[model samples]
Target: MKQLIVIGAGQGGLSAAIYAKLKGWDVLVLEGREQSGGKAGGIVQGDYLLDPGPSIIILPRLYEAVFAAAGRKMSDYLVFDKLPTISRIYFEGSPPLDLPGTREECLRTLKEIAPQDYRGIQDLLRKLGSVAPLVDKTVFSRPYLTSKDMLDPGLLQFGLRFNPLRNYRQMVDRWVTSPLLRAFFYGFPSYGGQTWNSKAPGAFLIPYYMIEDGVYFPRGGVRAIPAAFEKLAKELGVEFRYNSKVNEVLGNESKATGVRLTTGEVISAHAVVSNADKLSLLTPRDGDPGWEPSFSYFTCHWGISKTIQGLDHHVLVIPKNFETGFEELYDKRTFPTNPIVYLNAVGALDPLAQPPGKTLLFSVVTAPAEVKGIHWEESKWNYVKSVKSELRSAGIEWCEDDEEFQRIQTPSTFAQRDGNYRGSLYGPDEPHRLMGLFPLGNRDAKWDNLTFCGGSVQPGAGLPMVTLSGKFAVDLLSTR
Candidate 1:
């Protein structure tokens, strides 16, 4: 048996491990964290359950592929319910937009938002219908090793349905007339820690999944999906070692040979795959500084005493002064002290997410990676106070909003726990010019017997992209 040692236990890592085991490799998963699932992990605060990461499970078929590859069907392994309405958005008095999970319902709801914009939305939806196949044929089928994979003339037909050349921001600006509606539609790109303007045109598929494709919640929580995978992988002979952190990637003759753990065990394997933050892993070996941090977040995981009136499963409250609010966040990177809020009340939608009479909200807005070190130290607490005031000022929060159980996640917590590159999420904004070549395959990447996967790599970010990245890695190894 060829021993395989996977260096991380994130969604991509776990998926790779399970698939590798099925392919008949001797698999040993070494996770640095106390548990698996990486950013998709959940937190249990008293009786309230919160997943600060992964708002809703999109691309059900991709997740299904993960389960099936692990030798277990989703139904047999766990119960996941389809959310009737994928998510509901609050545009304030403009009327709430419920992103229903069916095609007809979505079209209907979108028409309600804007009758004139209906034509554009329908055209965009038709464009999205072609995205999955385009991805499979162009980027997903092969690793992004050469410039040709992304820019090949042959692949241009795949992008013809939608103009990948035009900036997405331009598209949104042209397609939607209402500022509130435009912001709501563009929120999809930013969902995965990316900006609509910076992300390629292909990301329009995000909303396609949200409304037409559907969203889901695991019967237990997001953790249930991985826990089931862990069980099934063990059933098929994959060993797991929690708290076994890899200090370095051992190499011989310029090729990876094994890994060195913090406990001093050098576990050699025929193949090595990393699902950890690729950017972080790159820093250890190269002795270089990353470009700059991506956007950081200040999230409040509040367990409200009772559900507030007029709120839905998902909410995006546009501030009375939207431009000023965004300028503070986009230009200053401060806590959007009074910025528009993106909120999700999971318990309101899924009872499994929280105890009775409680609501779990994942509220976050843009902030700089580091808080200027000193200035924010003085203003940190005050900034949070201001943020709270802003939320209530927007009329989304009421008198009892803060009285319930509450917890907050800051940059410091994520920095130490997740070892993310630069404490930012989603990664270094896809590097304007590096979009073509930079952040290429990790120097440690091996093709003969080893492979790579994850958001930082090609085919890009998001659960589906990363899942597809892992699947691509498995295909490479199996072919060899």
Candidate 2:
């Protein structure tokens, strides 16, 4: 049997291991941390479980495909409940908008919120639906390893549809006129660390997917998705090693033979798959231009003593002065004075995940990636205070008095924990993004036997994309 080694036990790594094992490879996964799931991992405070990263679940079929590949039912390992109201959008001084799962409900809600933009929203969805299949075929199915791959006629035509000349904000303005709708659409680019001025019209597909396919919450917590993958991978005969940090990828410039652990243990394999941050593992060639740091997140997980009423499973609070916040974050490269807040109250949906009469709230704000000027150690707590103030202003009366326990994660945390370049969750910044849609390729450019799979690779960030990235890496290896 062919010997395969996978570094990191993230969603991508676990998926890669499972696929490789089914292909009859003797697979071993080496994780730097003591457990699996990477950023999708959970934090436990007393009896409450808090998810520090990736709360929203979309495109669950990507996960289901993994189980189907193994001839096992996904439901047997993981249970997912589709959220009826995907998120409640709370705009300052305006009535809160409930974004429902199905198209009819969404349309109805839009009609109530912005009567004039209802038609615009419908047209936008139609346009997105038309291009959805092409996006899947061109972007998701493969990796762009060279200039030729990007210059394909089909891909070029796809790019032209979005009019790369205009930025995301311009594209959104053409689709809707209401501030509420604009607020809802404007932030999708930030999901991949792109800004409004970024030439990333492809970001519009995020809301398109949410409205079309529906958003889901896995039973137990967001961590349950990776837990499911880890369980299935183990059952399929893949092996795992925790706290096994890789020091180097050993081989020549053209190929990777295996990895050397930090303890100086040399483990040789026929092929090596890296699910760690590719930037951390690969050395940049001479004259290779450095990538700009992309946007990252500041997260606060709180286990509160009591639940806040009128809170949904997912809630988005858009400040009235959000444009200034965007300018501050993207152009000025500072923490926004009026940041948009995303609050995920898992207990609102899953009662079992929380202790009795307690709430599990995870709040996130988009922030600049770790840059030289801004020191998180000095400013993180101050930022947290501001975020709590914003939460209270939005009617969530969470205070230090009500807090049972709190856990905070900043870009610095991701930098240390995941070794992400400049602590960017979505790899390189927007201006330097690959074809304006992807991260790096799944196959390493210099090493034939080495591959990459994770947030920093093709198909891009978010749990669904990383899950697909694993399959893309395996497919590249199989083809070689």
Candidate 3:
């Protein structure tokens, strides 16, 4: 049987393993960590089951597609519950906006909060719905290998869906005048580590999926999603080796042979699929100075003794002056002293998340990837202060003394644990130019047997994209 070796057991790697197995190849997945899920992994502290990363789960249909492609039903392996209240946005000095999952409910809320913009909101939703399919079919489903790919006649169907001239912020500006709503809308680009000024088309559809398609949470915990994938892969006869880190990709001048583990064991395979940070593979020794690192996460996990009231399962605390905050973060390349905070209280949705009467807060602040001047250890306290102040202002409270348990994860911690270049959660920053919007290809141009799948590669980040990325890689390999 043809053998395939995948380095890393992230969503993309596991998905690739499953696809390869389905194609009648013997597959082996090597994961450095004791478990799977990559950044989406969970942490169990005392009575609290904490999801340290990727608290929001959008586009669950994409996940279901992966299982369906394997001739199985996702519900058989995992249970997903749709959230009625998707997200509650808290803006400084303004009334809060509790966004519901349905368009009718969202319009009702908009009419209540910003009555003047109700019709405008309706128009924007229509625009989002019109463009969503184009975005998915034109960019999300296919690979962009060359400039010619952009000229594909089918792209004409995308129409004004993208309207290449307007930035994401500008697109949102066309619909609403309220800063509170604008901030909420503009924040979607940050999901892929891009700014409001990103010219990448298809970003507008983010709200369409969140509001119309619906947001969901796994029944047991966020970790349950990956656990389900891993289980299915195992049942398919794919082998997994935990705590096995690959030190190098063994290759000839023309193609890859396999991977060499840190433990000095050499595993041979017909092809190699890497789910690690692409830069780690590109550099091998000292990284390229020219490559700008992607945004990393500054996460604070707290297990509070009491439940926090007036918070949805997912809550976003928008900075009062969002423009200045973005400037400080993207332009000045510094830690966000007054950053927006995303607080996920999954315990509100999943009873298994924490003990009764207690809350589990997983707070996230997007930060620049690790670089020379910034010191995470010294700056962590300020991040904590910013988070606490934002949470308090938004009417949620957590005290170090009152906490049953607390832990902090900085970029350095992520680097030490996952070997991500400079703790970048995604591979690289989303390119601002239209041409650069397409990520690096799934298959290597020079090495015939080498391919990549993960946040760093084409189709980009997020659970859905990464899972599809694996399929893209496998399809490419199978064609070769």
Best by lDDT: 2
Off-target runs (Cα >4 Å) in candidate 1 are 151-154, 162-165, 323-337, 366-383, 398-404, 432-450, 478-480
**lDDT measured at residue 68 in model 1 versus the true structure, 0 to 100:** 74
Highest TM-score model number: 2
The parts of candidate 3 lying over 4 Å away from their true place are 285-289, 430-434
- Tens-digit lDDT string for candidate 3 (1-480): 999998899888988999889998899999998999887777778987777777778888888888998899999998888888878889888777788877678778878887877777888788777767676776667666677877865566664456678887777787787877777777667667677777744666677788787888888788888889999999999999999999888888888888889899999999988888666775653356355666788899888888678777888899788777777776777877778888887776778888998888888888887866789999888789888998898888855788877789998887788777677766666562236566667777667887889887777778888998888888888887
Candidate 1 structure, TM-score to reference: 0.88
Q: Listing every candidate in turn, what is its Cα RMSD in Å to the true structure after a full C-alpha superposition?
A: 3.1, 1.8, 2.0
Please estimate how well model 3 matches the true structure, expressed as its whole-model Cα lDDT: 0.80
TM-score, each model?
0.88, 0.96, 0.95
Whichever of 2 and 3 has more lDDT, that candidate is: 2
Writing each residue's lDDT as its tens digit, candidate 2 over 205-288 gives: 889889988999988888888899999999989999999999778887677888899899999999999898787777433232
- Report the poorest 10 consecutive residues by lDDT, candidate 2: 281-290
Output the lDDT of residue 38, model 2.
96
Worst 10 residues of 3 by lDDT: 428-437
* Model 2 clashes, total count: 0
